[model samples]
Target: MKSEFYCWLANKLPRGLAYWCAIRVMSHAACANPAQEVDTLTPAQCLKAWPK
Candidate 1:
């Protein structure tokens, strides 16, 4: 759900901005404690699980 939104948002953004946004988002997600089941994921895991 969130990943979908992120991807959509990233697609709409400029390439450099999208990369920066993704890195920032992933960094925050990596540091934060899991709230939902999906939130428990590591950055690598999240990337893998993200829709391609």
Candidate 2:
């Protein structure tokens, strides 16, 4: 999902801004995906949802 989001952003944004935007957008998107259950997520969930 993170890969898909970056692929989507890379296609939409300029190179200079693509990475930053992708990171921010992916974070927001991950937190919003219903399957992920944002409300029940713990810090560990956060790490898993969008790990480095």
Candidate 3:
């Protein structure tokens, strides 16, 4: 496959961020989608959610 798009994109992005995005794009297939948003609790959110 040609990498003209990737080169153009990578040049526009800042440094190592391009590689980070590239790895995720290359590793995953079209059908296999990773969970982008997760529900988790932080100390502040926990306190706000269940305040005493």
Reference-based lDDT, each prediction: 0.66, 0.64, 0.47
Could you arrange the candidates by TM-score from highest to lowest? 1, 3, 2
lDDT of 1 by residue, 1-52 (tens): 9999977876788888878867766655554535635456666765654446
Output the TM-score of candidate 1: 0.41
The ten-residue window of minimal lDDT in model 2 covers: 43-52
Q: What is the C-alpha RMSD of each candidate to the true structure, in Å?
A: 8.2, 9.0, 15.7
Structural RMSD, model 2: 9.0
**lDDT sort, best first:** 1, 2, 3
TM-scores for all predictions: 0.41, 0.33, 0.33
Worst 10 residues of 1 by lDDT: 30-39
**Clash count (model 1, backbone only):** 0
Checking candidate 1 for backbone clashes, the offending pairs are none
Q: Which of the numbered candidates is closest to the native, going by highest lDDT?
A: 1
- TM-score of model number 2: 0.33
Give candidate 2 misplaced runs (Cα > 4 Å): 1-14, 34-52
lDDT of 3 by residue, 1-52 (tens): 3689867866899878877764444444221323322233333433343324
